[model samples]
Target: MTPAPAGLTCRLCGRADLRSVLDLGAAPPCQRFMTADQLDEPEPGLPLHLRLCADCLLLQIPPLLSPADNFTDYAYYSSFSSSWVAHARRFVERAARELLPADAFVVEVAANDGYLLQHVAARGIRCLGIEPSENCSDAARRRGVPVHTAFLDKATAERVRAEHGPADLVIANNVWAHVPDVVGFTRALATLVAEHGRISIEVHHALSLVRDAQFDTIYHEHFQYWTVLAAERALAVAGLRLVDVELLPTHGGSIRLWAVPAASDVPVSGAVARVRQLERTAGLDTPAGYQGLAPAVGQIRDGLLRLLLDARAAGQRVVGYGAAGKGQTLLNYAGVRPDLLAWIADKNPYKHGRYAPGTRIPVVDVDRIEQERPDLILVLPWNLREEITGQLSGVGRWGGRLVFAQPRLTVIDPGAAAIEGAA
Candidate 1:
């Protein structure tokens, strides 16, 4: 792959001096994980630099890596995890009760494998999904969920409006923050949704990411880290206004925002006002918030690298758990290679036969842990550390320990399960 650019202008506000909060050194491009036969030649490493808009307090990395580079046929599948399936089902059920009626149309963006939209369809409501990943779109189609394999923008919005009329409910989860054109993307939603339509967007809360030190979520694909304040500004610029909001435990503390056209009757709830107040208290939407993250992020990097180096020096075999996107970000930023981690294990079959995004570490079955019997196991998807620790309970039969790096690096014996509020 070719390099994208030296840096990018702010997608939300078009400003530069995008202060660098943390720099994860170059590693193999994440999501370029290939088969053994394709491994003779390697892909190029893009700069994994994290920046903040001092003016907007938006956390983002330059699109040093473009959307097309990362979103190929085999991007991601949502049906693999039963836990996530339940999460989607609950979301649809709640949406049906609180937001949508039986006769209205509901559209989902990046509706991989129709995992969430299936619930909406089952409620006898009209539904459509716009997914860019061909593999995931095919899977969704197989499940009888109509999916369009195309990137959504203003033009597509007009086309959809001409064909199916404006949507009554638009649901985009975790997709809004990945686009470089925040204004245009939200404008598309504004165009595609009717005046009476309701739009709900879910994205990682940038404020929580900084306060909790979830630095791993910073990557090439995630274009912007959105806070309620930042999103409100972008949406308002696109002719929409936020009405209601909720903080979800999903994806390491995400914000679910309900919005409508600026002229609509959707009442702006206290939740929106409360979230703005929270942003002010956290110093978000300003340059000071961006400046404050630098020092704390440095400490996290130093701590994790020191632990890995010390374990290597002591002749301990180390392995990684979870081939998660966030894990890839942390590995590339820390400059960790296959030399430090023997291999990685994951439950997602889509990645089981592939290597990691940047490290080129092969992903094997969960038994690799028991077979290799590594002295130390680093859990990359530390958010799921509890579930993983529960499943891998036998790791301690040979005295193995599991370590997680998040707010800080902590090592827990398998017998210990997990620390409170981890991940």
Candidate 2:
């Protein structure tokens, strides 16, 4: 992996006044799963640290790796998670009813596998997807969702606009934080939308990250973690006005922002002010709010290590669930290995035979859970705890328990209540 450039400046304001908030030392790229042959080869590690800009108040990490390094042949597929697809369906339905015109055209940036645009196309609306991964784009095409396999930039956005005209609704879900060029990408979003068109962006709220001690979400793939205050500043640079915002439960906690060209005379919704107040109340309006995160992160790491070691000492088998990017961060930071985690189960077949990047834990099919019936199943993607718990409810029949390692470690009997908390 490439080292972060010397004298790193804030990506948003181009200032060198970036304060270090939390550091996870160096870790391999979260999404870079290793093949069995490559396990013995040398692995590259990059610094995974969160910094706050004093000038712009943007919470970001240094751009250690480019987008191509992680996304070229992506391992993640949006359709794997049933709940996320249902979330996309609901967003498309709401956009068609309230935001779109009768003959509206839609464009989705970083649209993975056409999870959302499939819904738009099913409703007879004209839609297109701009994705960076060819494999993911192919999956979208199979679903009859037209996609252009290219990263969104100023030139690409201009070409798309010239060919298809301006889009009525441009949806960029959970991608605002993926790009290193924050201001430029925001400009591309503005360039893709019509003068009176609306742009929807979903990003993990920084408030949740700081408040809930969710340091696992801080990885190289996500360049920025945003709150309403920071988002408004970035949007203004692209001549887009933040008119509305909604708090979502996806990705631990997220906020969906609605924006329009500054030239448009649309009135800002009260939800924007309400969310700003919520951020202010949470102490996110200033850099002081970012304090105490590193210590909280340390406590979580210690707790997770204690749980895994105790389980091992007791002769209980503890396996993992969800071969997710965040899981990679948590495992590498806490120094978890195959001996402690055994094998991780994932529904995505692409990762079935591969090993996790740094720890080299095996990734297997979900059916292994039923075959082995491990005593403890650590649910890595805590955000999807409800859905994962329901799928593994049968583990209770075998006296298997579910474990959540973040925001505090909680052990729950599969079909019963939470039996333990914070080891």
- For each of the candidates, the C-alpha root-mean-square deviation to the true structure, in angstroms, is 3.5, 2.2
Q: What would the per-residue lDDT of candidate 1 be over residues 1-423, giving only the tens digit for each residue? A: 112245566778877656777666665655667787777776777776777766666677776665666665755677766667898899888878877766888888878889998887777788889888888888888887888787788888888888888898898988987787778889998888988898889898987787887878877778888889888889899989999889887777889999999999867898888888888898776756655565777777778788888889999999998787888888877778888887898877777788876577899888788778999889888876657788777888888888888766788777756543222
Model 2 whole-model lDDT (C-alpha atoms): 0.92
lDDT of 2 by residue, 325-399 (tens): 999999999999988999999999999999998999999999999999999999999999888988999999989
TM-score of 2: 0.98
Q: Give me the displacement of residue 68 in model 2, in angstroms.
A: 0.9
Instruction: Provide TM-scores for the models.
Output: 0.91, 0.98
- Give residue 225's lDDT in candidate 2 (0 to 100): 96
In order, what lDDT does every prediction score? 0.79, 0.92
lDDT, candidate 1, at 173? 87
